[model samples]
Target: MALTKLVQLENFRKRSGSETSVAKVLSYSYASPLLSSPLLSSPQVFNCTQLDDLLEVYYLSPLYALEFCLGFPGNLLVVIGYVVCLQEWRSINIYLFNLAVSDLLFLCTLPRLSWLYANGQKETSPYACIIRRIISYFLHVNLYSSILFMVWVSVDRFLLIRHPTRNHFLLRPKVAMAVAGLSWLAINIQVAPLIVLMFQDMQKAINSSRCTDFASLSGDTNSFGYSMGLTLTGYVLPFLGLCLSSYNIARLLKVQDAALQRRTTSYKRPLRVVTAAAAMFLVLYSPYHVMRNVRIASRQEWSGMELCTRMYIEGLYILTRPIAFLHSVINPVFYFLMGDQFRELLFAKFRQLLRKTGRQRGAT
Candidate 1:
């Protein structure tokens, strides 16, 4: 009986004339003794390769390119403006400077990311893979560091309002510098595990291209859990800090207005600015964090979910990536609006340059 079964399997393999067909035959032949069915047809594999190709080519490519173009010049001007126009560094200035620097670092990755997306293939070369890993590392580092610094900025504003005359330690430049350093260290430590996961992904895809977004990496079963933990620590905590700081500042401002018998509109500007910052924070980050988890969840096998539904979730996740980074462009505007002195100083410097050029032209 075993010999007959083996002969029948070999004969079927010979007649099918394709490697895939023969593999299917072998997969079923060893399972049962009787060949009751005519032949085991190849099972359909659920693949989203074409969907990924289209998303990379259309969505991420243009969006990342736009971010690089808009973010680079704005962040560069912030760094330059800080160095040139500001002679005295305060705690707020320290945080703002570091925030600009973090944005610049993240912006540096956008061009390479844009190229990778436009090409619509994962990187195969070791050098390219290493670069992609570095990009991922710095990307999260910038993200968390930026959030921490912004939280500090909100706290600084709160402190200035709450204790206008007192020199609180948190309001000191040296202490702010220490906080900034620790923030960078903490963010790096938090993001280090992602590098290991990416490395494992790289190893698994040695024969094929790899280096996808973290939500899409197929390295470890714990990736989804890790992502959830990261979102809570990196985003949720800082968001709460910002909200608390902003709320206290608004309350203090309102109290001061009542004490002085001033019009409600007298403090309206600061109140509005603080409220807007918090609102912007929620709008930009909440969707990204939510959709990212959904994307990761969609990759898992579910009882009754369709592949098309998973594709739609991934597409929404892709849309949030660039939108979350739009803060880089909005941040410079905040610099000018929030710091009246800095804006005046920057404008004065530009006018001085213009005057010098005009005088030189006249001399010639």
Candidate 2:
């Protein structure tokens, strides 16, 4: 009877173990749906949690505000300076004019970005989300368009100095306009898919106000690829183009005939303008592009960097981004300081404004 009881006890233990195993399987079955749900699977939800609030408030907000304050009027003056001298618009000036317009459009988005940063991510309305996406779209448009037009200007200057008689057809005002239009079209086409993806992602986040945080997007692989591609096309290639153009122009400036040099004294201002532009691209824009790539890499799953390292990269990106915005303000300064024609026109406009104010005062 004792042996029988031992057997029954062992059997009971096996039954209980089976029951426990079955219960675990049932629990896992029930939990799988929850794990697979969109809310749980969405990467943005986790990315948003990881975002450094301190970086946004103390650094990005103030910098964006400062950029807005300076860039708006600065870019506006550049546009006005070009516009006031419409009759004098050459192929090169057309490119510069478009660059100023791109900068102005970019500056328009800063106030909204500033407000978004200052307020933090509250529950964003759908309209607000749409507006933010549009702004972000144009921000990128401005960036690449500016780079492209600057390349055009550099190439034009290069040809003027290096091969003045080779590409006479390309130096026409109509040809410049056509090139500018084609550039705009190409950029818009490149960015259209990205805009669509952004909008779709924003729509999915029904209550999120963080429209500008691309780091919070789904699919790390896609984002990483896009960022890398943008870095290459938008920055690396253009920078190489500028460097080559500048080098050629510099060599030509050094080795020209004395009579040709005397005749080209008027070209000194444009040469200075081109040199300043190249320097600006190197100093202000290169760091931002490098940091942007680093930041994007840190956001990827395979980066394998520590949290502190990632945070450092994020901070560096924020700092460098504002430096890029400084280009808008500084470009106008380049125009006024380097381009005698731009300065003359700007001064004439100011004088006309002052005279009008005096006339109004006298009438009053």
Candidate 3:
């Protein structure tokens, strides 16, 4: 919001003609109208508001920097660990591996924003706008495809338990690749229009140009439709599918023996994994999307927020960025905790403990 205040102040300056120096500096980008009122000519657009400028210098930049520095490295490490530590050739693991790669593409753009803001929003360019859009496209695709793959994994488990004889085809390697491909294609179809609507030739409102959901900006009708679509496609359906599968799996386990139930629950760690992934999704993404949709519905600018609203939005930064990074990081932890092969590989210490316990019981 502070950064937005600075831009608005710049806009007011560009409205009155007194601030020739500021206009001259921003003119190099060829997007002087971004801050200036469109009706005012460049020479006429000079004026400044004191309170707005003071807040910009004091608040937004430092807070944004602190958030980014903590999230970036952890996001990168998630992808690296998955590739090196995970064995290849399984379909589910491959999709997760690629998901991490997509998130890292997003992680890479933060420093670009950090630099742009640290320089007082002067270094922003049209190319940065395009980069932001491209990164967003990939990130959205990852969001959809990752959830779709998880649903597929869940249903496959559901079938494997309920009808183990006939539909075992769901577990094949080739079929998983086909599922992955179909997931990517479907998400691409959903998000391709965002590329057309990206509005990347200019920068606006400070550093958020580094990442954005431009689909939410296409006037009220399109904005409402886009949010609904995102809410349904990215959120509602995924959560529903996960809950349904978990419900069925839990029900099916209820009639089994105690020993079998323990073993089954141990192997069902993927349920917990998916649940954590969804929680992180809600944590990081919900606030950003909700605020964006609210902005669209109200048809107001970002700067008009009251002090409390602004602080709440700013405060979400602590949860939002880290959870986004955690979305990338926790998948590897999921694999380490849940993957059957990795479990076998790492359970050697547990094996020793079990053996010692068995010997002690026999001696007694």
Highest-lDDT candidate: 1
Query: Ten-residue segment with the worst summed lDDT in candidate 3?
Result: 43-52
Per-model TM values vs. the true structure:
0.83, 0.77, 0.63
> Per model, how many backbone clashes are there?
0, 0, 11
Model 3 error, position 91 (Å): 3.4
- List the candidate 1 regions with Cα displacement exceeding 4 Å: 1-49, 263-268, 301-305
Q: Please, what are the lDDT tens digits per residue for candidate 1 over residues 194-276?
A: 98888777776666555677877766546778889999999999989888877887788778877888555634565566667
lDDT, candidates in the order shown: 0.75, 0.68, 0.52
For candidate 1, report its TM-score.
Answer: 0.83
Residue by residue across 41-93, what tens digits does model 2's lDDT show? 33432342234555677777888889889878888877876776656667878
lDDT of 3 at 227: 63
For candidate 1, the per-residue lDDT at 198 reads: 82
**Residue 342: error of model 2 in Å?**
3.0
lDDT by residue (93-157, candidate 3, tens digit) is 55555555655565565555445445544425656656656655766676566566667666665
Ranking of all predicted structures according to lDDT, beginning with the best and ending with the worst:
1, 2, 3
- With candidate 1 superimposed using the best TM-score fit, by how many Å does residue 238's alpha carbon deviate from the native? 0.8
